[model samples]
Target: MSTEHNDLTAANREAWDSKAKEYDAKPWQKKIASQVAEALNSHADWLGADWASASDQECHLLDYACGTGSVTRALSTHITHATGIDISSAMLSQYTSLLSSTHPSLVLKTSVADLCSPDPQPSISGPEFHNFDIAGVALGFHHFANPATCIANLASRLKKDGVLFIVDWLPNKIAPGEHIGHAHAHPDSHDHNHNHNHVKEEETEEWKKMKKTIKTNGFTEEDMRKIFEEAGFEEFGFVVLGEKFVLEMNGKKVEKTGFIAKGRKV
Candidate 1:
């Protein structure tokens, strides 16, 4: 990876780490995360979306950049074992706590590892590495500084015929504007005492910026497919969630959703 990409990965890691604490406390975020998980779990059957169930087989699964395991919990219901990875320690901590409290029987495991980096490929070294039947990244792929290299690294860790699920924001959608100027920009930061109106405005602006930035970061249906294909994924196809996510785009109402592309490791 280039130095530029390395630096970007560092920044993303920092951003996620800072926001981890407050992210866990937000009730709305909890709802959204759970919803994402539920959607994936349900939609899998329709798209033949089993990462590990090739030939009706069961296998271990990994959730890359799994923030607090929102999707992990959803995936856990279907798969026997699921593990989530994030660069933020705090976020993983909260995920573990949540699993222990809400779903004790679920075998939810987490670790602090930057998926964008080459030196410390967490999934490959973790106890679960050899066990993973499929690896997934939800709404987290574009954050990589060098997406191509990251995709290549992730692909190397999977078993033959093992699948990879790449889920993220799709283009041609409405979204909220960026609110970093008014609301809490850091992850560990909180703004409970802030006025409701101010929060709304900030979130509105933030939503817009997010969409723009995601576009700038080289995110799109075509880009995702190319990256996965280049990294040795085959039989890839796109799947989008029907739910409309509310956000602001240039001060306009926007409903942003995601698409999941699944492929087999050739």
Candidate 2:
């Protein structure tokens, strides 16, 4: 990685570490976890014996960017064991605490390592991830310092035919400017009122630079499909899950939408 890339990764790691406590306290985490679990569980059931009936020894999940183990906790009944990896120590600390109490059935392992690490992901508390059947990165890709490379590395970690599931934000606007801050649209409940397709004409130079230095709003469906395909995943599909989440910002309603994408490693 370039010096600049390394610096950004360090910054993101620190930010998430500090926010670990506040993040676990948020009610939104529970809601997001529930929706994510439902999607994974249903997909597992539909995938039949390949995913649904496999024994704990036969199938394991790698929950990439699994802060606080939210997705793993929600997926308790769907899969057998899981190994969650992240860059934040404090976040992993919180993840361990929750797992011991709220999700004992998960048979989970936690580690603190980013995609850039060269050694086998060493867990301060658990074990390295290997030969997993399902991999998920939930509400976490936008934090990646280099998403494409990260996806490819993650693909390498999975066994053949293993599935990957990703859930995250996909904002429809590009509010360009230095530190313009992330923008999320708010529509009526369960409504997808804004166009999520890229609008290049509306972007300014500041926005272009920002895309390199910081993760903007998030990845679009088409953007994600291309990335997954590049990472050697086949049969790509993306779908909006649940409903529009309306939040109040400065007394106005700001709506955020969520989407999930799944693919199988070829």
Candidate 3:
């Protein structure tokens, strides 16, 4: 990876690690998580036919950039096993804790690894990580330094005809001086007790630091389609969720529309 990309990976790892403990503590975070999960479940067709009809033991999911296993939790009932990979160890710890506590019987595991790295570790590139029936990243695309490379890496892990999907924000126009933070931005950091015309001046420093970890505001349908095709995937499909998510960031309420895009490995 380039030095710039490595720096971004480190920054994001630190950002997510710092927030892992209380990631979904806010009501809005929980609500968004639940809604995204439901949307994924409701549109199983985008996940491919094998995912729709396969027996539990026959399907395996690779939850890439899987912060606390939101995608895994969403599709656990349908797949026999889920392997999660993320750069943040703390986030993986949260995933482990949640899986053990709520889904004890489910076969879900996580590792601190970054497949986006040009030279992935043996443990991450091994057979164990390959041939997944489906690979998905929920709300993570915008944080990636290179979305096309990320998609190619994830695509390499799937078997022929396997599916790869991403659930993230669709491109939205931001009005003048309006700031729309990433979906996972912490609500607690914002002072909600007071009304303000702009984001708090004190929060600007922190936001600046956090913004380093975000690579883009959002992706368009055409962008997703081109990347998926470049990654050697076919049967592409994209769906915008029916519900919009309202995220409170440093006292600013930013409404976002989320979309899911998928393609089959060929």
Per-model TM-score, in order, reads 0.73, 0.75, 0.87
Q: Rate the local accuracy (lDDT) of all candidates.
A: 0.62, 0.66, 0.79
Q: Write one digit per residue (lDDT tens) for candidate 1, span 140-199.
A: 765656567667766776777777777765544212332222112221122234344544
* 183-265 per-residue lDDT for model 3 (tens digits): 33333222335445646445665566676787667777888899999999999999888888777665556677889999999
For candidate 2, what's the RMSD? 7.0
Regions more than 4 Å wrong, model 2? 46-49, 52-58, 116-128, 174-214, 246-253
Error of 3 at 47 (Å): 2.2
The digit string of per-residue lDDT tens for model 2 on 1-266 reads 57756776776676677678877564554555666677666665543324535454545878888888877776666677878788888888888887879877667777777774433544432324666788888877765657777788788777788888788767545433211222322221123333356442354543333334345455678778888999899978787866754443232344667787878888
Descending-TM-score candidate ranking:
3, 2, 1
Candidate 1, superposed: residue stretches over 4 Å from native: 24-28, 46-58, 120-127, 172-218, 248-254
RMSD to the hidden true structure, all candidates: 7.1, 7.0, 4.3
- Among residues 3 or more apart in sequence or in different chains, the pairs in candidate 3 whose N, CA or C atoms overlap within 3 Å are none
Whole-model lDDT, candidate 3?
A: 0.79
